[model samples]
Structure formats: C-alpha cells, structure tokens
Target: MTVLEQTGRRPAALAGLWGGLALTSGVALTATSGWLIVRAAERPVILTLLTAIVGVRAFGMARPLFRHLERLRSHDSALADLATARTEVYAALIPLTPARLGRRSRSAVLAGVVDDLTDVVESHVRVRVPVLSAGVAALFAILLTGALEPGAGVLVATWSALVVLLARWGLALEREAQPLLGAARAEVSRAAELVARHTPRLQAIGAAGDVLTRLDAAHTGLARALRTQSRGRALVTGGVLVLTGVTTVVMAVIAGRAELPSAVTALLVVVPAALADTVLPFADAVRAQARAEQSRAGVETLLDQTAAVADVGRGRQSSTAPHLRLEGVSAGWVEGRVDVGPVDLDLAPGRRVGVVGANGSGKSTLLAVLARALDPASGRYLVDGRDVTELAADAVRELLAVVDDEPHVFAADLRANLALAQPDASDQDLVDALRVCGLESWFDALPDGLGTRIGSGGRGVSGGERARLALTRAVLSRRPVILLDEPVAHLDHATATSVMRDVWAATSGRTVVVVSHRHEGLDAVDQVIDLTPTRKD
Candidate 1:
C-alpha cells in the first residue's frame, strides 16, 4: 500500500473525537466558572451556587482527562502509520537503488525519504486532530450561545467563519515558504555531508576553505527560509488573538443589550475568549497541512518513476557466469541524451577488462549497463550470445558483484559486517576472505580481532582499509563476476596498487570489469578501453 493509503484514519478520527471532548470541556469550564462568579456575587441562595461550583469542578477535571486520552490515541496512530510507511517506502525503493535515485548519493536520497515520510505521517496528529477538534468545539459553542442569545450566537458564528478563512490564508503562506525551506535544508545537508565524508580530500586539495564557504552560504539560506516561514506563522497566530479580542468585545455588547440572566450574560461574554484557545492551535495545523502536501508530492514523484531498467523478461537461469558482450552499446541517465556511447566489448568468463575514461566520458554509465542496473538505450548487450533484454535483470545481476568508490560500513562488529556477503560462512571463511583482500595483517592488529566494532561510533578506518573491506565482501560473495568502479579511487598510489594486486589474486578465475580514470590498477587487467572524448571542432 502507498504511504498515504495507510494513514490510520480510524484512530485519528477517534483521537479527534476525544480532542473535541477535551476542548469542549475546557470551554464549558470557562463559561461555568464565569457564571458561578457572577451568580455568587449577586448573593444568590447557597444551594443555587452549590450546583454551579460542582459543574465548574466537573468540567475542569474532565478537560485534563479527555486531553490525556486524546494525546495517547493521536500519538499512537501517528506512530503506527509512520512504521508502515517506512517499511513500504524502503521496500519500494530497493528496485530503484543505484540507478533510479538520480545523481545524489544513496545516503542523501535515503535521508530525504526518511524525513519526508515523517512529515507525511505527522499530519494525522498535527493537522487532522487539531482541525477536527476546533471544528467540533466551535460548532458546540455556536449552538449553546445561539440558544441563550441569538445575537451573541451570530457573532460567534461569524468569528468562527473568519477563523477558517484566516487558516486558509495561513496555509497558503506556509505552502509558499515550504518549498524554499525544504530546498535550503537539503542544500545544507548536502554541503554538510560532502565536508563530513571528504574532509581529507578537501583539505589535501586546499579546497576546504571553499567548501566551508559554501556550507556557510547554505546555512545562511536556511536561516532566511526559517525566518520567512516564521513570519507566516506569526501572522496567523497573531491574527487569531486579534479576532478573539474583537469577538469578545462584540459578544459583551450583545449580552448587555439582551434580556438574559446575569449568569447567562457572563457565559456569553466568556465564550469567545475560551474558544480562542482551541482556534490558536490551528496555526500549527495550517503549517503541518502545507508541509504534508509538499512531502507527499516529493515522495510520490520519486516512487512513481518508471525504473530505468525493465523487470519483465524471460526467466533464464544460469549456473555460472555467462559470457557478456556489449555490441556498440550506449546509455544515459536521461532520455533523449546519450552519456556514453558506441563502444564494443567482450567478456568471456575469467577475462579481466579495464575501462579508462576522463570525467563525463560515461565509464560509470557503461558499468551500470553491464551490471544490469540500467538498460541500453540503443545497440545490444548480450549474455551467453542471447540478448540481455530477453533475460531477467535479477537473474543477470546474481552472477555479478559490484564494488564502487563509495562503500558504506555499517555500525557493526567486524564479523557481522563481513558476514553479510556470505551469511552462512564460518569465522574461518571470513578470515580467509580478509586474507585474500590483503586485510589479514590489519585484522590481526585489530584490538578485538573479528569482534572489533567499526563504523560511525567505533574504530575509524583509513581509506585504504575501507576499500579493502569492500573488496573482502565482494571476494566472499563468490559471484563469479566482479565489477569494480574506481574501488581504490580515494586511496593513494601505493595503497591503490597493493589493493588492486590483492583484487587480482582473489578473483583469479572470475570475470572482472574495472572502470577507472587513473592508471593505478589497469596493468593487471587483460585489456583496457580508453574513452577520452574528442573535440568536435
């Protein structure tokens, strides 16, 4: 089910019911207390005042009790919806990974999805409950006041109608600001992640200052967007208070000229002020309503995209790696544009090929096509002499393992991290894979051996070590075909050569296709294809 489809509507509706009761209780408390004060001051009989005092007590206690129940139900519903949305969105994104996520890093894309989903689910409590609660309480106030004094009732109804209009205006302002705020926040996040992930590279190239300047600019834009958003909320909340003051004044005049009892007149005067409390929360609801709309649009835009590669093809199974060939194959991330081109290549089993290209030469694009993450736009890609389009993409992908420049290390122990590639492998098998990836010495030196914690909060890893760890996983997979896309790009010359040496040794009998702009690892490959673009002029 889509995220919007599982919004826990029933629970939110129940919460709104409870919330309405709580707000109505609060309004009743205010009106009753006012009535009791006025009636007691008139020196009424003690028994008459006793009932008013008891009513005041009852409503005061009911407000808190109902409010507590409302909170419990509303929050529970939001949490339940959030859980389902996260699970479904994650599952839906799996097929689109690496290719359909656009040019953003996977971490950034996933982070955006997480934040958007939270916003969408939060609407149940922030938007639905508040609007429904206010609506119910306002309707009750209008009826009660109209019964006692029709003129006062008209004033209350007008005030409520104006409040609804004001909420619509507030929502429009919020919608205007949301896009700016979202873009600014995303820029801040992107800039921050770049600095955090590539601090050493930035410092090494003396570009740290420039990047920091860009980060500062991003923050400035975010602060500006926040100010813009706050202005809208301020206008809305301030308008609610001003309207309440006017309504209360008009209500007093109506009650004063009416033929009602002193106690009833006081109740009419206090009604508008009491309802103000409930209406004030609408400002927050307006903002949330606007935010949820934008978030849902973003998520739908992403999830609704047709995948770059087709899924329905003949279900051909392969017992071993098939001979792959790209006959004048070309592909691109966008339609009507070719990023990489008219290249010819052949990969018989166990043959190692290297693709060398300058930046923008589409080396990665070709590798994506080879890995079945992307479909060729023109020409043919063949597996075992059969057109690749005729075979299931997943079946073709099963024989290959890809290691890219950016390999993530989970916050886990050494054994757990490496074991994901081969879940049933023993400790000895893990150690062997580490040895094959040239990480045996590093493993032995670890403080806790295979038990050592790594990533985020644990022991830090050098770039070379991180690359080797990824290699270890690829080696352990035993997929028969390895595709390395600049796996050692971030490492220094010596480390890159050493890692490539281990890579060659570990995959001796496996077909390998390595793409890199650098010459550090190409010597080990059987053949190299250079794709330096020529100037048309």
Candidate 2:
C-alpha cells in the first residue's frame, strides 16, 4: 500500500475539500470578473448589472477566504500525519534496532529513515491536495463551459488532457531521477557526518583532504540530479502556459462563430487563463508524487524484516545473579550468513570474561547476542538453564546493561544523562558512578557539576569522556550482566588501559563480558575467549 494510503483518510479528505473550494472560488472569481467587465463595456443598465457585480464581489472575497482555510487544513493534516508516521515507524524499528539497521553507521541509516518518513508524509500536502483541488476546479470549468457552448467545452477538455499528459511525463522524469538523487543525498549525509564528528582526527592524520574531496563529489552529483529533475517541472510549466494561450484563442474564435452573448464570450475566453493556476501546480504535484513513491519504498524495505527475536512470554525473572550460557549458538546479522559461533560457553555469577577476535570474526556480534540485542539462529542461549528464546525479550534485557563504543550523551543536564541508567539515583550516587568510571576529574572540572548541560548543543565531550560516561551509566544500572562492546575502542593505548582498569575496579562483583580486539584490557579479565574461526581446507 502507498504511504499516503497508510496515513488515515479523514485528514486527506478534509484537506482535499478545503483545497478544492479554494481553487473553485479562484476560477469562479476570474470568470465572473471577466463577464462583469464585458457586460459593463456594453453600457448595461445599472439595475441589470447588479447580479454580476454582486457575483464578482462575492467570488473575489471567497477566493482569499477559501485559500486561507485550505492552507490551514492542508498543513494541519500533514503535520498530524507526520506525527503519527514518526511514532509508528519508531515503534516498528524497536525490534530491529542495531542488528537489522546495520553493523556500523546505524545512525546514518536511521537518519535516512527520518528523511524518508518526512517525504512520505509531506506528500499529503504537496501532491494529494493540489491534485484534488485541480481536479475539482477543472471539472467545474468543463461542466460550466459545456452548458454555455459545447465547442468551448471540447477545447477545455482537450487542453486538460494535454496538461495531464504533461504531468505524467514530468512524473516519469522525476521517478527516473529519484534513485540518483537519493544516492547523492546519502553520500552527502555520510560524508558530512564523518567530517563533523571526526574533523580533528582526520586533519591530525592528514586525511582531511580526501574526505573533503568525497564531499565535493557528492555535492556535484546532487546538483546534477536536481538539474535533471527540474527539467521535468520546467517542461510541464511551460507546456501548461502554452496550452492555456492556445485554448483561450480557440475559445474566443469558437464563441464568435457561435454568436454567443458578449459576456458569455468573455467568460469563455478568460476560463483557460483562470484554469492556468490550477494546472500549473500539477508539475509540482507530479514531482512530489515521484519523491513520495521512492521514500515509501525505502520505509517499506526497512520495516519488512521480521524481528530478530520474539517475546514468547514474560518468563521467570532471575533470582540474584543468574547463570547465562551459550551452547553452540550460531547467529548472523543477516540471514544465511552466520558470522559468529557454533561453540559453547558458560557465564556463572560474578564471572569476568573477555572476548578477543580479529576483524569480521564477530566479537561484537557475540556480545550483541549475549546482551539480548540479537537472537541466535541455531542452538540454545539459556538463562538459568532455560532457553531464553522461550522468555520475554525485555525480561532478558533487564538482566543486562550494554556499554558500546559510541554512547549517546543526551542534550540535558548531567544528572539527567546519568539518571537514564538509574532514574532513582541520588546526586551523590551519580557523582560516585562518574568517579568509578574515571571521570571524577572531569566531573570536578564541570562548571555546573551535576547540573551541567552536555550534548549536541551543550558542553562538548571528548571521546575518552564519552566512553567513560557510558561506563558510568552501565555501572549505575547495577544489572547482573554488564556487556561492554569495545567501550574503549576509540581511546589511545594508555587511556584504554586506564579506562579498563577502572571498569574492572567498578564492576568487581558483577558478571562482565568485555569484547575487544586490543589486548590492553583483556589482561584484567578472568578468562579470554578467542573467536578466530577455524577454516577447513
């Protein structure tokens, strides 16, 4: 089903109603004004002209009034649909988070989803309202002119068909250009994000020039696609104006031959000009339709995958620190590509295990499975000797706290950011958690301490600090199992070792699983599991 169809029908209908009224009023005003002017030129008696004068005045007033109402209704409906679409899409993505999203650069994928949703929802206002309004006004014109003179009616009908044909051609062009446009946009986004987040590092490593070159290339491609798309709209716009001119001349000639009344002839001549406003917007509507179609396809593709795991039942909660085990557990981010495991492991309470593997050997994948962010494709992942697949996913998640390399620092007070891990935590508890994560010096340096606002728009956080902040949150959660997925990956060797030291010191009594390719932190763990896959020749 189309994305527009998924947004409820009532708002769309109301928008159409308002838009149609506005367009109809404008056409009527133009036609009546033309008739009034012609009748006045004939020196009609004042009394005889009263009705036409009153019609012209009423139509003129109604035009703006209806247009104002149309604007309000259309925008309100679009915003409402946007709100609903965002909520529904977010809910649908919860189960697919991190795994189906992508192995890396999940934020970029999510950002694309947001853009697509906006495009799809915006179609209600941009495409549907305009098309519906034009359709209604054109129908009114056809019926009115047909009653006055069948020849004029035929001329208008033929002109309308040509306009529709033009719009269709424009839509085809826009559709053909959409994929290229979308790719260009994605490249721009990826490049911009990379530069923004790592500008200093890129420059320090002397790779800044290469990244900027890529950004320039992406922008150039985007410009070319936009130019191609604009040609379609230009064709439609020029065609509509040209057609309107031809139709007006044809109507005037036909009216003269029919021996129509002067006022009627004037109305017939002016009708095409009035209809130009309605027809011109069809170019924009066609372009919007093409964009909406592409965006809808993207949203559908992302949401089509089945959830990684099912919530079978609420399941029994673990009493104290429960035993977790992975027995020959094989899993993959994508189907039919098992990237990790066909092995055995056990996690007793308070056990500290480290996972080490080369790139693509699936260190993070194993951690994701353990953290309940992913489900195993084969074999059993048991919690307290029972298969976790039979239990509620949320219940399994509740027992674990995850600290990944990239942890988001929300745009709020320092207290609120840390409080996400433990909402009921006191200020002292928060401070202690930071101290344990080796952020004590940084916390002390903060001007507002716990009240400091630090995120996108607030105080900047260094990479090491961000990693420590994540560790602080994990420490505060007090979950039985703390899964660290390369939490210190971004830090230098010395800092990584220092952070790992504090991590081990902070979570001394919990079941900790640290996944890392670096050897800096592995020495502190009780056991190290090497995930290097054995190849059979």
Candidate 3:
C-alpha cells in the first residue's frame, strides 16, 4: 500500500540499486557533454583530448543506463501488480453495504492507469534524472570555469541560483494546474456515476433529458477547469523561455569579455540549459503528486473496506462441514427495516433446489449469500466440506457462477464475450457452448459469425438473447456450484421453455439453486424453498 517507500525491504530491494545506477549514468552524460564543448575551444590537440574524455563519459554511462532500465521495468511491473492487487480490494468492497460500485469507478481506475501511473514514472525519473545530470554537469562546469578563470567560476555559480529560481517559478504554475485538472476529472467521474445509476429510472420516466442536463453541466465544468489549467501551464512555459533568455544574455556578456576562449565560454554558458532541463521535470512532478494523492486515497478507502469485512473476527471452520451454511446472516432491502434471514442453514453438494417466493421475500438475498458475492451481517459459509474462510475469496469466486435476471453482455463480438468466461477456450469449445445454450444457429447465421460485435449493453440483441448468452457463460464454466437467481424470468413461453430445457440439461450433475417466480420453471426441481413475504402494516 505504501507505494513509495524506502524501507529496508524484500520486494525489489534492487529499486535502490537501479536508482543509483541511473543517477550515475545520467551524471556521466552531462559531464561528457560539457567536457566535449570545453575541449573543442582549444587548439586541435586539446580539442582531440577533450573530445576523447567527453566520449569516455558516454561509454561510462552505458552499463548504468542498462541497469537502470531493468529497474524501471521491475518497478513498472510492480506497479501493475499493485493495480491487480487493488482490483481485488474493489471486488471485496462491493457487496459490503452497497450493491454495486459507482460506474465512475471505471473511469477513475482508467485515469489512474492512463495518467496517474505516468505521473509516478515521470516524477521518479524527473526527480532522479535532472538532479543527477545537472549536479554532474554543474560540477564539471565549475571545474572548467575555475581552471580557465576564477571570475568565470564565480559567474557560473551565481547563474545556477537564477536557474533554480526559474524552475521554482515554473513549478508554482504547474502546481496550480494539477489540482484544477484533478478537480475536473473528479467531476467527470461523479457525473458518469450519476448517469449510469439513473439510466434505468430515466428510461422508465422518459426523463432522459434530465440526465443529459446533468451530463452537460458536468462536462461544462470539466471543460472550463481544463482550459484554466492549460492556460496556466502555457503561462509557465512562457515564463521559462523568458527566464532562459535573460540568463543566456547575462552569461553571454560575461563569457564574451572573459579571458577564457570561446569554446570554454560556450561550455560555461551553454551547459546551464542542460542543468535547466534537469529541474524541468518538477512541473510534471507537481501534477503527479496531486493525481497520486487522489488515487492513493481511493486505494486506501478500498483497502480499509476490505479490512473491515474480512473474516478475521470470525472463527474458522472445523467440524460438521455443510456444503453451504449461514448463521446470523441478516441484512435489509431498506436499511433498518424489512430485514430478513439470520437463518442457520445447510445444503449438500450437487443438490438441485428451488428458491420460491412472492415479491419482497428474502430469497434473492440467500442466493447472494451462497454465491459469496454478498456478505452476511454475521455467518459461517461452508463449501466442499471446507470453511470458505480457509480460501482466498478470489479463488473461491472461481468456483461458482451466477445467472442474474439481468446480465451484462459486453459490447463485443460473440467469441470475445464467451472468452470472458474462459480466455483460452478453443473455437470448437465456443461452438459447443453456443450449441448447448441454443444460440449456435443464431450466432452462425450472423454475417460475422462469432465475430459480430454487439452494441453497447447488448443493444443490437434482444433481451432474451442477452439472457441466454449470460446463462451460457455460467453453464459453460461448469463451476462447482451454480446459482441461477432468475435465468428465464424475461423470456416468453417458447423461448423460456427452450432455455429452461438447456438449464436442466447442463446442470444434470452440478450443484444448483434456482430462484424464479415461474412455477413451470421449477416443476422439475428437487425441493421448493418457500419464502413468502411477511405481511406488512
């Protein structure tokens, strides 16, 4: 979690070693460059000697640069792994108190990937590269100046402060831009979430225009904020040029009259630009700092939520293994009231069962609890003669699949959609899956076959097809346990019958618990779990 740490550590202790090597190499590049300029000022003999010395610095840098690149690669891989680790936290955080994450979470995560990660890489590189390069460059510059004339050495030292000042001025402008840009991105995230959450209600009420109004307002705010930040960054750049020009003029005057020859004068004056370039990364660093703060806080929140719900406080499983069981598993539809089911229960493996209920019964919540997608207020869940607490939840998730009443079909081709369930599935395997789901003909008849791209949220497909497709994924996985909350709730008579037939066929030897309002859908099931709604005042 402490991404930027410098502890005596185990994971990639080589980060420090890489940092040192990169610093050493960058210094050599700077020193070589300055020496080449200084030596070229003298006669051919001196020029020849200076040129070789300059070239030596280049050669000296090669090994360090190679090692540093390896380090960069290691750190980048570490960062990516960290991202994967954070994703697990997000998965764990959902189904805690809330039902789903803010849709803005997707874009926020993307921003962290697209811009925030870049900020870390650039910030580290900038902080390392410039200081090392300039330090080496400045040291050589001073030595050359002192040898030529003490007055020139003193002048070089004086102008170094001006360069640092200019860097600070540029940094201030960049600092302001970073926060403004961060604010704009946050607004965009919030607006995206608002729209995703309200889309269903908006369609129901024909109030889509109101959703557009919210979107437009958020976009307008973001656009205005970005423009302001862009203008500020532009101003900083202009200031950099002005500062660079003034120093060049002052140094030019001093070098032109000094006893040192033209080449030495050039080295004394021209080399400062490289030094200036060194500190330039600070402007970028400022923005990185702001974005990193926002992302890190987001990650922290996610981790904290994970820690809060962890089974650490509960006892581990020992005897009396129940394929599934829940104790004190209480939660509610509307926070304090309408709560249901602290029911202690158990089920056997490979048992087919039906969860029957009228509207508002706690049937669906029970399915969620068994799926490990929802946590009970307090409970013990056993799977496969072992306590679930004994397994990493992520690994446990791989063991079960759910077919919700409404399922999301990615805006992707048929093959791509199926691949989400099993990325390495063969073509024939996909064809077999389609066949089992009664969708093979529908897919094969398409102009693009499995390559036909569906519209967003299955726009180009019918609701029944979407339902079947989602069911297909769960069926194909053939997980140890399958929870079908409402596999055929939206299908018409004939279509529902076909889907239900396949459901029964595929689940022949699997453990399955289905929840459905359709009596016909459950007529063939082993036992019916009757969860009638409690009468309300």
Count of residue pairs whose backbone atoms collide, per candidate = 0, 0, 0
Residue 403 CA error for candidate 2 (Å)?
1.1
Candidate order (lDDT): 1, 2, 3
- For residues 1-537, what per-residue lDDT tens digits would candidate 1 score against the true structure? 355866878898999999999999999999999998998889978998888889989999998999999999999889988988999899888778777888787987898899889889999999889888888899999999999988887899999999988888888889999999999998998899989989999999999999999999999999999998887688779999999999988888888888678889999999999999998988888888888899899998889988888877877856596898999998988888899998899999999999998999999999999999888999999989888778888889888999998888999999999999999999999999999889988998999999999998999999999989998999899898899999888888999899889889888999999999788878888999987788898
Candidate 2 vs candidate 3: the lDDT winner is 2
- Maximum-lDDT candidate: 1
Q: Would you estimate the TM-scores of all the predictions?
A: 0.89, 0.89, 0.68
The C-alpha lDDT values of all candidates are 0.90, 0.87, 0.62
Candidate 2 clashes between residue pairs 3 or more apart in a chain or in different chains: none
- What is the Cα-based lDDT of residue 517 in candidate 2? 83
Residue-wise C-alpha lDDT for candidate 2, range 380-431, written one tens digit per residue: 8999988887788888888999988789999999999999999999999999
Q: How do the residues 34-121 of candidate 3 rate in per-residue lDDT, one tens digit apiece?
A: 5565665554676467556756666576746755664675567556645655465445445453333333344444455445444443
How does model 3 score by TM-score? 0.68
